[model samples]
Target: EADTCIADTAVVEVVPLDMTVADSTVVECDSVAEVVVEPVDFSLVDSVEVVEAVDNPSEIRLNWDDVNYIERNTSLGGILDVIVLGDNTEYVGYIIRNNPVSGIRFKTLDNKVHMLKWDDIVIYSRRPLDPEKSILSQSPLISTYTFAGLKPLEGLIVEQDYETGLITIETADGSVQRNSARITNITNRPNENLYTPKRKTTKRRAVY
Candidate 1:
């Protein structure tokens, strides 16, 4: 009778074996479903990275001084970066004016004025003249440069006298006087639009 009872207990345990197999199959199905969803999560992460890349440019800030704090000694001429032709000598100072007797008058930051001749100067501009840029101007008081390679200096025409063939230019940093013979072209400024006004705008919340 004891041996018969032991055999009956073993037969009962067999039912649980089939249930364990069914539970294992369910677990495998769930794992496969999770694997499919994992790719979607990865895609979402990739999309966020792309959005960050696109928005990064908007976050960048550029800084520049609106007014020059350096005290200017000489009243005439704009601050210009000048490069001489032969020695390629570079200078940063006030180009006072084009002197009919002396040439291109320049005053150094140290307060010494120089007469840079028409033939000697390679280029002069507020910044160094880029050799690879389209030169455009809209001033009636045009003073053509003697050298073809020299870029035309565009600024406010402060003074003009056809009799002396002298034209005075009040540059951003200083003043310049040039002969009409050096001037290639001329256009009238009926509206007197020499300088274009520029306004800067930013996102209101970004100001702080």
Candidate 2:
């Protein structure tokens, strides 16, 4: 036989078991219960801070060493202008290696590979090529006035060695080298000096 219990208006069947029910209680409801939920504050949560983006994130400012490192790794090579410290012989070619033991190796325009010791090189310059500047254009005859009582060499400047303070000029006869310290001034064109002195002006005094 089965027993019956009333849960509000619905009848619930109670099955007989080998267990005893003590202090049994029942509550009656007439309607569906409504839940009241309190709103949670999200202001206490930590937010991620955003940084200002740069215009060029991947763009790099490369130094001479950085350029060498990149070129060594890429093996593509780049143009280099170098001068020998002893003989002052100028060479222009594509630098291929940065060897410490064998020295710097480069390929010349004539398809010749040459290696020179770092100590043997005085001027090692690498710059971006400008299409506007060319040797084919007519250059002014530069005359370098020397502090020493010597005849000034008038020709086109081939290169200016800042490290050794020497200027190489190309003349009709051959290349000539001059010490920058010995030269006082360089005149490119007559009446149009390369460097001009500032004009002195008299200051007016206020009457007391």
Candidate 3:
């Protein structure tokens, strides 16, 4: 014997998820209905996108029979502190341009510009902590790429050989460009607090 809604007037619908919205919301219905929510604009104001990189250091290491994956980050030598997609949209980058079939261009650090489409990439790199091994013995190299026969980008250039978990690509064009992707996971996690580019120290004394 329980059934409520002896209709007189009813209209309640509130839908607005993500684009930042808040215009109206009031629900106390007795005989008055009017709920419409629609407002979305993910404004990336100023949109910093001025990418420019072509130095190509292409860091890598995590093969040697997997070598326990090693994990302990913080070696910004060529500067890549990268992290892509899978909800981990962190990119303090510099890959400039790695064409494995015309796809892969990252020049971020606020100055945005990220163009990745080797199937949107899943695991690019991770094998650091060996700059003479003194960052308190670092160890971190996970994700040995698992994209088998992944096609569509026409194989232009993709090289990530974490020792033996091979992945070499290059359809043509002097074919032999395998940066593959580096700085795999310099501590990737809801990351984005990067601005480490300040080093000017040189004090050498010799010539006797």
Candidate 4:
């Protein structure tokens, strides 16, 4: 026969699982999942380069081509009345009346006044009679060159003349001596007496 047994105390204990099993259990039992996202592609993008405009140099240049400073002499269209003082042989000088001014006159080869104009007059010396021996042929004889622009009875002389006084107030349309005595003041008139020969050829021989 068996003997009867009695009595006692109780104890509780826990067991751990393998590492791979534990990792697998954590992944499978997770309540939420994680994911990695990528950026989207675009059809058009912002430009990186800047563009500038250019200007033309010719548009800013200045022009100053004009002919305003030139002076032109036009004929007034009237008969230029002139007087021949002496014969061609011994014509040293002449006394001119009705001159545009109170001075002597000389002519050029082309019939144009050389130093004087229609408004001015010149009293020039004559060419030498003998060209072979004397150099006087080449000399200039313009003793007095005056103009109406000068003060009345006032004249400028390159050389002095003893026959007549330097300051001779004269009438514009009268004889020299008569005008001299009656001279009081200067007159402003366009009429002038040019001692230059009416024909240009008359002075050609003297120029050479």
lDDT of 2 by residue, 1-208 (tens): 0122334555444444333232333445564333222333333323444445432234455554445332343222222344455577766666667765556776766778787776776765542233354321223224445447678776555666657778766654777787767876565442123223344444443322
When 1 and 4 are scored with TM-score, the better candidate is 1
Off by over 4 Å in 2: 1-80, 131-208
lDDT rank order: 2, 1, 3, 4
What's the TM-score of every candidate structure?
0.27, 0.29, 0.18, 0.18
| lDDT to native, each model | 0.43, 0.51, 0.42, 0.28
After superposing candidate 3, which stretches have Cα over 4 Å from the reference? 1-66, 93-208
Which parts of model 4 are misplaced by more than 4 Å? 1-74, 81-109, 112-177, 188-208
C-alpha RMSD values across all candidates? 19.1, 23.2, 23.9, 35.8
How do the candidates rank by TM-score, highest first?
Answer: 2, 1, 3, 4
Q: Any idea what lDDT model 1 has?
A: 0.43
In Å, residue 123's CA in model 3 sits off its true spot by 4.7
Q: Say which candidate scores most in TM-score.
A: 2
144, model 4: CA deviation in Å?
A: 24
Task: Judging by TM-score, tell me the better candidate of 2 and 3.
Answer: 2
RMSD of 1: 19.1
Candidate 3 lDDT, 1-208, residue by residue in tens: 1223323566545565764765654444365544455565554343344434433334666555645323322344322435455555545545556665656676666777778765556445422224553221232211222233432222222345433344444332332333334323222211112233334444443331
